[model samples]
Target: MTDHETNETAAEVKVDRQRPETPSYEEVLFYERKPAGFWVRFWAYLIDLLVVTALTSILVKPVFALVGLETSGVPWYAPYAILSALIFYGYFVLMTKFFRQTVGKMIMGIRVVSLKTDDLSWMTLLFREWIGRFISVTIWPLYWIVGFTPLKQGVHDYIADTTVVHEESFRKNKLLQKKTPDGSGLHETSAF
Candidate 1:
């Protein structure tokens, strides 16, 4: 290389290292994600629940009707509980891992992210969701409260170190409304 080219390269390299660090607020603006609050998260949650319910109902009810199994030997509520569990859990796993949100969340333009980083993974999604079903259901009559909890985290979220967050617009709207990621006014912290 020519001497002039080498000098220019050296000057650029030095300038790169001398750049000042961006502050936390700047990082938050750029990255530094926060969890969604209860209800906005709830909106997404309700969407998922509704979708899952509609789907499983569509799939299961017809089969029962076609085969006359509704009252053949299987009970009505039994199918609802057992089938709902499988459908909901399966739907939760698929959407959270692959799509990073359910149909409702997708419509709402919200997604879940890692607690510290703004990324998602299958393992993270699986563990967080499985823990969600186990802990939230086992602890209460319904897993509904998880949607009401701060960060929209239920008991399992505590175990998984995960948090649900709304889309960027939702968070900004939340800040403006003095509401939560879910649009609730609840003041809360993580399980820790």
Candidate 2:
């Protein structure tokens, strides 16, 4: 080919190889739903504990009184203690399983969401509320881990792959625009 013809061919190739124009920065407005923090969760737990105590008092105390059974000075292995423990664990397990939140959580406007599955399962409830809660209750300090974790996950939350989130609440999140693979335009994905 002649030099002039070769130059024209090179120009055509350069034009063909030109990438599409894309914006460098794009401001995206979105809502990011944050998890329930430590204080809120603490208040909810306190409320639940009060409810459990009230239930135990109203339900078990009267029954023990009727039967003339001693309510005080009972060991952890005592029948009253066993029944109370059952009520405590059962309250959490059944409430979480059916409502996805306990009464306290409902009052606090928070709910548990399963991360590993679309819906909460029986096994998840058992693991989170019964076994995992048992550990948290025993250690107590493990509950504070929520304050430090990125997702505000506690021991039970980590074990169950669940997170507590505010119902019907969100914070505005601004994300920088990311370039598309073909450099066609800016792209943004929802934080959810």
Candidate 3:
């Protein structure tokens, strides 16, 4: 082959390699990813609160005791309270950042996903877990908005452009089938 021909063939092959395989009409399926409801999320958050309380009692209480710090009757801005707040925010931030779910969320079979990006970023985590959570915690009723929203998103979710969804809810089932030339069934599957 001529050099020009060979280069053209190589370019064609590269373009083909970059192109995605388009599924035929027979392979198309419709399925919706169910957003976590308020009750489930409430339970998950309750579990996380229990975990945070336990962690604070086990980890923070000891340090305060050892340092002769009085935790009782102290103001909210006290050193112990500040450390506890740090732990609270840190737990949510780190867990969501690393696993996309906290221990409670894992138990509840729910996970946080970003609507805007494929992967969660630090800024997203900070906004969702820290600042957003602080607001939710303060207002308390803002968490209830999850149930009312079309996508079942909480205030924090709205702020960070994230949503909680049931884990691995998508499954390949025979939602629709087509007959092949040999009378075999062609199954349709759902995609996330």
Candidate 4:
């Protein structure tokens, strides 16, 4: 071999030895295949709808009252439906982005995750929770296809390259399970 090629190979070996190897998220989730099935995801969505409905009613009342819409003095052009839509989108996007699961999903022990990664990203959450959902809602059958999919992913999930998984099942997977610094099985959440 040429002298330059020999030196480059030796340098690569030295770099590999000096650098500490960290596992990629894909590697961690490889053995974790327990995606949330139809019933569980459906129940979680139902619970989330109830929660959002309650919260929207409570929040909308004050805003509507301020704009005189609650008591029937509002302008004809007032966008009440748009406001509601925004609230719904915000609730799902923000909650899933920060907590990995909405209140309903938490109750059902399910969480949204990227198909190829361990942590969820903001863009992925937006597409998954908003754009994908909008399409699913407009085309209802697309959402129902989750029941027959191997990974239990609906059209929305496929669009976002995401999947909903049973959080407990994921944590229980021996290959993916990780212990806290304190030896607890639970993941650490920041206190803020």
Cα RMSD for candidates in order: 16.0, 5.8, 13.8, 13.5
lDDT of candidate model 1 versus the reference: 0.67
TM-scores of the models, in the given order? 0.58, 0.77, 0.73, 0.66
The alpha-carbon deviation from the true structure for residue 139 of candidate 4, after best TM-score superposition, in angstroms, is: 1.3
Candidate 1 weakest ten by summed lDDT: 22-31
Rank by TM-score, descending?
Answer: 2, 3, 4, 1
The lDDT values for all models are 0.67, 0.89, 0.88, 0.79
Clashing pairs in 2: none
Per-residue lDDT tens digits for candidate 2, residues 1-192, read 899999999999898789665546666888756799999999999999999999999999999999999989999999999999999999999998889999999999999998878799998889899889999999989988999998899999999999999998887778777667767886765342
lDDT of 3 at 27: 42
lDDT of 4 by residue, 1-192 (tens): 999999999999999999976533211323464889888988988898998888778988678777767524445355766676787889899999889889999999998888778788887887888889999989988888999997899988998899888876743232344345556454533221
lDDT of 1 at 43: 76
lDDT of 1 by residue, 1-192 (tens): 999999999999999889964322111122334566656666776788899878887987778778765623455468656776788889988987887778888877777676756666666676778776677657774556565666667666666677666576443212212224555554443221
How far does residue 90 in candidate 2 sit from its true spot (Å)? Answer: 0.7
Residues 75-170, model 3: lDDT tens digits: 999999998999999999999999999999999999999998989999999999988899999998998899999778988999999999999685
- 138, model 1: CA deviation in Å? 4.1
Candidate 4 backbone clash number? 0
List ranges where model 3 is wrong by over 4 Å: 1-29, 170-192
Candidate 3 residue-wise lDDT at 22: 57
Clashes per model (N, Cα, C within 3 A): 5, 0, 0, 0
Best by lDDT: 2
